[model samples]
Target chain A: VARPRIEQAQQHLDSLTKPPGSLGRLEEVAARIAAMHPEGKPQIRKRGVFLFAADHGVVVEQVSAYPQEVTAQMVLNFLQGGAAINVLARHAGAEVTVIDMGVNHNFDRQLPLLHKKITKGTGNLRRGPAMTREQAEAALTVGVELATQAQRDGIDLIGTGDMGIGNTTASAAILSVLSGHAPEAITGHGTGIDAATRRHKVAVIEDALRLHQLDPTDPIDVLAKVGGFEIAGIAGLILGAAAQALPVVIDGVVSIAAATVAYQLKPDVVDYLFASHNSTEPACRAGFQILGQEPLLDLQMRLGEGTGAILAMNLIEAAVKIYSEMATFDTAGVSRKQLP
Target chain B: VARPRIEQAQQHLDSLTKPPGSLGRLEEVAARIAAMHPEGKPQIRKRGVFLFAADHGVVVEQVSAYPQEVTAQMVLNFLQGGAAINVLARHAGAEVTVIDMGVNHNFDRQLPLLHKKITKGTGNLRRGPAMTREQAEAALTVGVELATQAQRDGIDLIGTGDMGIGNTTASAAILSVLSGHAPEAITGHGTGIDAATRRHKVAVIEDALRLHQLDPTDPIDVLAKVGGFEIAGIAGLILGAAAQALPVVIDGVVSIAAATVAYQLKPDVVDYLFASHNSTEPACRAGFQILGQEPLLDLQMRLGEGTGAILAMNLIEAAVKIYSEMATFDTAGVSRKQLP
Candidate 1:
């Protein structure tokens, strides 16, 4: 039933009276939604962005130069609307909610913070599993709850973004497991790390994989063993969004890894996923390919503060508007013939 | 006097609260404006984007696969808000007005059109000068008038974009003479032309330069010989924007060439100019250096429909809002230093 509805949406999009495939990946998203609700018009009236923040215990391994404190600092930056994500979100006309899935610091209760701590950050993933299976489930449950609540508040399009120090290493590990690639092929310099540090980070990821004896077949199991709480939460957000037939715009590599895990859990979930942009990170391209999605923007961006997702949000609005507006060529009374 | 204003603006931007010199080229424009009006705050409240559309007579030389009619077709596309520039401008919150500077077609009277034809698009430059000095001046005057009207409408920013087929060949020719480089160095595969067609385009430009005996030192002489009517007009627009103390965001290689000519005319005009992005065109980077301006974005974009400028417009708004709306440390009562 879901497959036919998805096909119906795509057929309606193909008939929308513009140059076929001119809108790029946006056309794919519009079609996917059209298929989701074949009986009604596809609409994105209310949009919500979920910013999941956590601390990565891999920072303890000196993989990143920035202190774990920067994660909390950036979370404050987001709350105060001082980050690039804030500016882009305001421009995209989307409401943003920051969730403290698992941060090391004690946050103020009045800051609209959602307390969904799986653990006081993950255990040092360089040594063993970042979080237990039970902890991963708890974080995923938190994400599910957040998405359900957003849907109740009338959100039809949900975007996933994340904030954490040294999390890119975790994302690379997850990508390797999901894409069946080696660590060297996916690991990259995150947050201005030098070449030597990058090599060390890759080694740490490879070491952790061997220690945990992580399986490539089960993505959630791999994530539970090596991913940050925020990454697991975002994966759950992707699932929750798809379960409700809402679209999820995945951000950079970390969010991409999350979406990959969610898709592994439910292949049908990809019917509701749209990749926002290609990150400079090599892992991002592999992740996008694994999910069979093409990113809309390629600005060589690697700053994973949801900047790519925010930039791609405007195009989604344009796509949906084209679906809803723009009279057909028959109505516009313009000839389709090539000019003489 | 303009020199002092530019220096003052640069110094003021340097003094702003943030990482010093971290904002890159954006800080340069803010500083130039500070120098322009030492006592007044720099403001970019109202913006006008001029999209100059024309067809190159050189296209008749078999230098391009698409006929000249595609120029007019794209112009119509711009007016209908179907082009990439239209989408980006809508996101940037700028009003776009298309000028039919020299297209060889009669637009319907009912359609929105600005007729400033210069000899129905200049005679093929491969034979001689693309246009007469008088015709070039007339086209430039049209641009001046447009800028004056934008000023009257309370515009504080002016941007230049163009839609002319085969203009890259002309731009490469002009850039070669202006930058004292050979044509081959500046020329690129414009509009995805085949390798064979590109060689022909390069040869055409070289022959045109030799036939005209264009002097590299004289900017106006070089422009009259190889520049498009729209290119000259854009150069005039940059001067007009600078004359009014408004920032002018330049689009791609063509717009950068205009900025170069404008700077040559009045070095202080560089104060009001901002390079929107570093184009993939080799000539554009040289033009930026020649004008002593840096681009806000470096996306390797070569699309000359003002898309780059539109992308940067949002960043400008963000920078200004930060400058105007962010509370000072004293006012916000937030500690600037780390807590003891």
Candidate 2:
């Protein structure tokens, strides 16, 4: 971040007609965006949602409510523009692209989606590693390459989302290993699971953690052990967006897992990342704690497909407009604080 | 609220592609909007923001940070489309109307604004009644009449915002009387007042509450004693929106104060109202507690001109689209949970 530009943005916002800092989070968001640009002006002209789809071997443990094949089905639903994320991204004027990282199914046709599958899915974490270290690195590299392509495509901002049947279990396992929190504490009902299934999901994550006592500093080792391909891809996108000075918005739990991996891999990556909303998922809160950031909206949304991120992009745009469009007190002839 | 449609909305939402209630408050908002319409479908085609501008005599007691004239100046700022509210409302595709409700100043010529001045301003509550019971009623009636006109104009949704230099002081006083909370707890720094001035503002509200000793049940009596004209107008517009079955979004502290009055006047009006965002003002929380409702956003915004409400309208529109646009599980060829 351009640290000095933050101070400059604050000074500019104070001169606006409204009370100093009375805009609250809106002002903070605007100033943060300003600090991102070289000219100290924040503008988001084009936005995109890079939704990565993959399959989780952990689904074999009966951790998720939906079937494993639902991941590919939802990807097709997204391609057809019949999903919640498509509707929301359209409302927010953002484009949606499905990045096929490692889903268990195949399109087997020329589809309007990125096909970069890594062997249909990762191995089940309960038995051993989810994927090899090389596979993890390849997924991450693909994500970085995709972000570079987006930058070339003139995208000003991008959001990360994930779709995998048991990805939340992988997210919980990652959070447990990184944050050293108990599985029960950071595991939640993913895609509407019953209480018994939630307990089982926690147990499944606990088993994974026990099977692979991952290193906190080795983000790649951790991703290779218990993380989904989509999780690694998300982390790579975060790193790539940070590398390119492009702002990235992190969505719900799966994205948070990716963010946790990215933050550990490169701590400075936090500067370019913004949390979209407070997801009801427990790992989301824990991951945000590790990032030391607050999510913007608190609507308790847990759906991932970059839906929450798209909703928050509207606020970020509004903040930029508030900073750039609103007149100063001098220009508007508004009175200043009396007896301040 | 058409209470049965809430269940119908739930049932219908569950059949969509995503998991049941995964959208969180978005689902609740869509359900509430669905319940409002007889067809059990939610759609927000035309949204408008009704902004009320007035003046408060409490500025004489040194309770506000800004001079009273800033209210009129900001209103003109809004009229010029250079205010934060104007920018945000335009972004959200919502139209804004300036309603001059006893703003202590006159345009004297025709302007593109509503002229519903009840008086020069409300009398200082520390000394006596802010306005007569008849004046408060008149302000509220004008608000209702405006809603009726909006209904004729095909506005399906409306939002309430207030602009008055010292309106937050009156709001704190009203909340103190109605919620039985002490002024020291509910009163806050309005419009960037210093710490010492905030303490003084609290003392001023405390003095007004003591001078009035208002009845909690008698909303009109309470408004007559301590509330500002804009607050009454906001309350009136809320009541009018409820009468017309039009959804209304409540903005910040001043709008909360008016909502407190209207909710007390007719408790059923909450069915038609949605708290936009949790304001930085302490009184807004107290008011929402009274209404037994939770706000949709938590951006910590305090800029009142319905800026928060306008930002939230984008989400509401997204929620309606999610409810009406997304494909069902059968249509999308997606598998449901294998077992409950």
Candidate 3:
């Protein structure tokens, strides 16, 4: 962050028609964006949401409400612009890109899909590590490559999303290892599972955590042992955006797990990332605590398809507009506050 | 609220690609809008924000940080599209209308103004009632009349905002009576007051509340005793919107004070109210508790110029689009969750 530009932005915010420091977080958002683009006008016109679609082998344990096939089907729905993500992205004036990372299904050749498959799917984590260390690294590499491509294609803002069934199990397991919280303490009913299914899911995650004995210090170890392929991809996206000095907004629990990994790798990446919301997932709250990034919105959304991320685009744009357009008290001939 | 249409909206939400209720409050918003329209499509194309500008004679008590004249100046700033509300309303695709309810200063005839002045300004509450019962009624009538005009002119949504110096003290006084909280517990550093000034502001509210001994059941008596002109206007706007069955998005503390009064008038008006964000004001939080309404956003914003209300228009529009668009499970051939 550029200190001079941030100071300048704060000065500008103070001079607005309203009382000084009255705009609250909106002013902070403006200051941060000003620091991001020191030239001052940090407009977010070309926004893109990278939807990483994959399937988790852990669903074989019946941990999720929906079937694994729903992941691939939703990917297709996203391509056809029939999903919640598609609706929200369109509303936010952002383009959506569906990345087929490891869906365990084939897509039509004519569809606008980014083929970055690390594998068909990872091994079931209830027994052992979900994927080898090499495969985890490869998935993260793909995310970085996709983010680089977006930045090269004139995308100013990137939003991270996932479409993997039973991925919340993986996210919870990873968080349990990283935060040292019990599986039941961090687990939530992903996709609205029943009581028995939730208990079963918790038992599966506890088994996975014990079986892998993952290293808390090493995020890659955590990802290979418990995280899903799309989670690794999202981690890479955050790292790539940070390296390129681009802002990346992350969605829900899955995205938070990825952000945790990215933050572990490079603490500076936290500056480049924006948490879209504090999801209903109990583990997501733990992940945010570990990262110390407050979400901009909290609608209790648990659909991790960049829906929350895209909704925040409006707020980000409003902050930029207020920073760039609103006249100062001096310019507008408005009187300033009288201090006693 | 239409039951059949709300049921239909819920069915549509369930049939979407994501899990049922994964959209959370967004789904609830869609159902409410569906109930409002009931015929199927609920659109919010035309949005209007009514900024009621006025002045408070209580500023003579030195309870505010800014001079009272800034109220009229901000009214001009709003008209010139140079205020924070103007910037945010433009960003949210909403039109801004500045109504001169009781600003102490005069405006140029060339300027576009509602010119609905009830009085020059309210009497200092520390001395006596802010306004006569008749003036309080008239100011509220202005709000209803303005809302009716907006609805007739094709505004599908109404957002209420207020700009009046020392209004926060008045708001705290109103809430202190309604919520039965002590003055210090409800008062805050409105517009960034110093430590001594904040103490003085609380003392002023305490005196006003004790002097009036206002009846909580009679909202009109409370407003007449301590509320500013713009606050009454906003109360009237909420009543008018409810009478017309129009959705009214309300801004921060000042707006909530108005809402408290309006709710007291007609409890059914709560059905039409959408809280934009929870303000940082301690009294605003208590006001929301009294109204039993949870805000959609909480940005810690203290600038009460309909900025938060305008920002909420984006979320409302997104909900409508998601309800009206997005292929259902049957239409898109997606599978639903299997409940045990």
Candidate 4:
């Protein structure tokens, strides 16, 4: 039902005054929304970027080269508008909100912290499940609450990104379980880890799968057992965005893993998920292919501080504008060129 | 001399209030400019993007699947705000001026076209020289005039981009001749050409090299014989921008080839050039390495039409803001953290 409508909108938009397919992926997105609500224009006035920050217990395994403290430092950097994501978001005119999902540090309650700590961080997944079923649910609930608040604020477009050191290992574990791929196939040398460290990271994910008796076919169970708090929260955000009819620009491999979980939980949620870019991670291409989503950008970028999503914000805006403003050929008094 | 000044500026900027080397290449750019001026803060204002359009005679060899007619069609696309470069330049708030360096069509004399056509197009480079030395000089002179006008209009920053369907082939030929690399090493499948077509394109360039008796060491001679008019114009634009002390964001392979020629002609002119992105073109890396410049971005982008340069405009703004803003640590009354 959703696919037909989106496709119809795309067809309508393509037939507008400009050259067919000249707007590139922007045309695709605009058409998708037109299909979503065939009777009215799809507006993206209140855009919100939800940045979920947490601590990956895999940092305890010494897999990441950077100290775990860099995660908190980067959060402060984001607040101060010094990070690349901040610069990109500012350029796109997107409102960014940071969530301290389960970071180890404590901040003043009045400092706008969401305060949804899920066990202060997951235990190192090399030994066991990152979070129990109850904690994962709590994290998802937090995501739901965030999305609900965004909807109340009239946010029509929701983009999900994350900041968690060593979370790539968590993403690989979740992806392996969700996509039915082996750990080695989905795992990558995240954040410039050496080959030995990457191999060790893969082994840790494998150990976690065996310890949890994870079922690759069941995404929710996989997320509950192996997903980081931020990953679960992003999944919730995707589901919530879909429930509210808001589009979600899922960023990179980690976000795709979250989207997979969200789609598994609610199959219709795929309508709201727009994969932002084909990340450098090999698993990301497979993930998008399985989900039947095409990314707007194909830069070999793997720096997952929501950089790719922020860049895609401009493309999304262009799509919405074309949908709203582009006059049809008849209205613009332009004749279509006859096909040769 | 430019290299040392840029290095000095980078060092001074690294000592600013924020974390050392945290702002990445933006800081480096600002610092480079600061070192060049020494007395006053480096400023970037009144930015202009010169979109040089031409038709390559090499298109006669079927080097590009897109017909030569697409060149003029895209020029109209640029004027009508339907091209990717137009959208991106609009987003960056930079003014664009289109120049018909050597289009195969004639227009009203009263139109704003710069009558710089060396020929209807280059001579089919597969057979002989693309342009005579006199024609190449005339094209370069046109670029110089355009830059001079931009400077008079108070533009402190200029960017070079090109629009010609078969220009990538020309860029590859120029780069191979200048860098002494085999054509196959520098040539790529431009605009989705098939492997067989790509090989043919490379062989055509190799044939051109043999027919012209081109010396790999003489860059200007190579460019004069094998480069498109737009490339010659861009070489002049780089030199013109340097003469005025204005920074120019050099686009991908074609623009880099132009800059290489300009540098060979006037070694000191390299001061004004900044590599926008290391394009997916294999020759681009060698070009940048030869110029001793690092690109601001490396997203594997091969789409010319100034998309990469426009994308980098935001980073330049960030760098300039950091150079001009951001209270020093002493002024902010914040103690600097001791290095670990």
Instruction: Give each prediction's root-mean-square deviation over alpha carbons.
Output: 5.5, 1.2, 1.4, 5.4
Residue-level lDDT for A108 in candidate 3:
75
**Candidate achieving higher lDDT, 1 or 4:** 4
Give every collision pair in model 4: A5-A35, A9-A31, A10-A31, B9-B31
Best by DockQ: 2
lDDT of 3 by residue, B1-340 (tens): 6677778878877877778889888998888887898765888879999999888989999998888888888888888888898888878888898899999987886788889888889999999999999999999999999889988999998999999998999999999899999988989988888889989999899888878888999999999999999999999999999999999999999999999999999998888888889888899888889888889998888898898898887898898888888888877778888755
- The C-alpha TM-scores of every prediction are 0.78, 0.98, 0.98, 0.76
Interface DockQ of each model: 0.13, 0.82, 0.77, 0.12
Ranking by TM-score: 2, 3, 1, 4
lDDT (C-alpha) at residue B238 in model 3: 96
Clashing residue pairs in candidate 3, if any?
none
Error of 2 at A25 (Å): 1.0
Tens digits of per-residue lDDT for model 1, A249-326: 889999999998888888888878888877767899889888998886665556666666766666666556656554
- Model 3 residue B191 distance off true place after TM-score fit, in angstroms: 0.5
In terms of lDDT, the best-performing candidate is: 2
lDDT of each: 0.75, 0.89, 0.88, 0.76
Worst 10 residues of 4 chain A by lDDT: A331-340
A162 in model 4: Cα distance from truth in Å?
A: 2.3
Report the number of the highest-TM-score candidate: 2
Q: In candidate 2, what are the lDDT values of residues A243-304, reduced to their tens digit?
A: 99888989998998899899999999998888999888888788999999899988888889
> What is each candidate's fraction of native interface contacts (fnat)?
0.01, 0.85, 0.80, 0.01
